[model samples]
Target: MATAWFPLWLTLKVALLATLGSGVVGILLALLIARSRLWLRDGLDGVIMLPMVLPPTVLGYYLIVVVGRNGMLGRWLYERFGVSLIFTWQGAVLAASIVSLPLIYKAARAAFEEVDPSLENAARLLGSGEAAVFLRVTLPLALRGIGAGLMLSFARAMGEFGATLMIAGNLPGRTQTLSIAIYDAVQAGDDHRAGLLSLLMSAVCITLLFLSGRLLRARHRA
Candidate 1:
């Protein structure tokens, strides 16, 4: 039987987009929180990490409340812009991005915190602006950690099923992802397809984890 490659392609596409989106947002938020006062930082950090600890179904429900057809934001978008995220590929991306954010944020924040303050201070003394200092000094030093975070987030996004299914529904060739496809295959008694997809997903996740470990080791060596 010819393997259905669409789920794999869709999974990669969603994971890639989610990783990019979460990476940018996560880094910025991590930096901001790291520099914030204790109270504000704690509050924001807890809020940002809520999705990580919450049950996936619970998070998906909240997402639905916020973006479902009759939902607050969803209603406005649908009426004004004719945009419907629910039951769409974009919704899957959104779900994946949300769930992957905490991994990126935590890793990036830890990396940022480990950066030498003296280096930043020296750059400032040398007339480097905040942006310049971050670009030239801080970011470079933390690149490895950030890269690891991106990979981890990609892995998480690729495996996201509950939230994506809740919002995007399992529409083959549209919103059905690898994880979803695997589940569908099993339900339909297509064990062979499910096993193949499961193996592929495992391989991808393991490869990402291996790369992340290498990046961490390299950072330590540096």
Candidate 2:
């Protein structure tokens, strides 16, 4: 029914936005780190990649501490603009983005690292600025890899549950994503709904992964 479909649409919305936001940020970070000679690069990479290996509950706890009502940034935003992310759909998006960021960052970093420095240097010597070389040569070569990362991040965002539930709660039609909806349905003894949502989640994840694999293979070929 319409009620059942709400979670599906909401999940898609959150995943799409999270993937897009993270993709841009991740690629930029990757580029910066790739070109940098700073000693802190490794430390920065470790921090960004931590969420991938860390427990979801642990990440959720950190999110709460950082963005909760009494938390520093959270309190400032609330006092200044009355904007609260806790228990909101925006919070869900933030949770998803944080958890999936590592996948995009790693993949994009590898792609950027693989680009031939000679090519970029040639472009630079030919009157092309750094930005032009990156956009025209480096990005084109790395596009397939970045596409794969985007899909992987999208899948992770769509499947986000624990962190999302902790920050966004399981409010139907508001912050309840597909993964949270499945959990809520099961807890409420709605086995049919839970099963349906599970199948849908599996199908979507499979599709995204399949596309990601295709992109990776294409990158290898090119």
- lDDT score, candidate 1, position 103: 99
Expressed as tens digits, the lDDT of each residue in 1-222 for candidate 2 is: 567688989999999999988998899999999989989999999999999999988898899998889889899989999998999999999999999999999999999999999999999999999889989999998888788888889988999988999999989989988889888889999999899988888887887778778777877887
Candidate 2 has its poorest 10 consecutive residues by lDDT at: 211-220
Q: Which stretches of candidate 2 lie over 4 Å from their true place?
A: 210-222
Where does candidate 2 clash, by residue pair?
Answer: none
TM-score for each predicted model, relative to the true structure: 0.93, 0.93
Considering only N, C-alpha and C atoms within 3 Å, which residue pairs clash in candidate 1?
Answer: none
* Model 1 regions more than 4 Å off: 1-3, 210-222
Candidate 1 at 11: error in angstroms?
0.2
Which lDDT tens digits does candidate 1 get at residues 13-107? 99999999999999999999987776677888999999899999899999999999989999999999999999999999999999999999999
Q: In terms of lDDT, which candidate is strongest? A: 1
Shift in Å, residue 71, candidate 1:
0.7
Question: Candidate 1 lDDT (Cα, whole model)?
Answer: 0.92
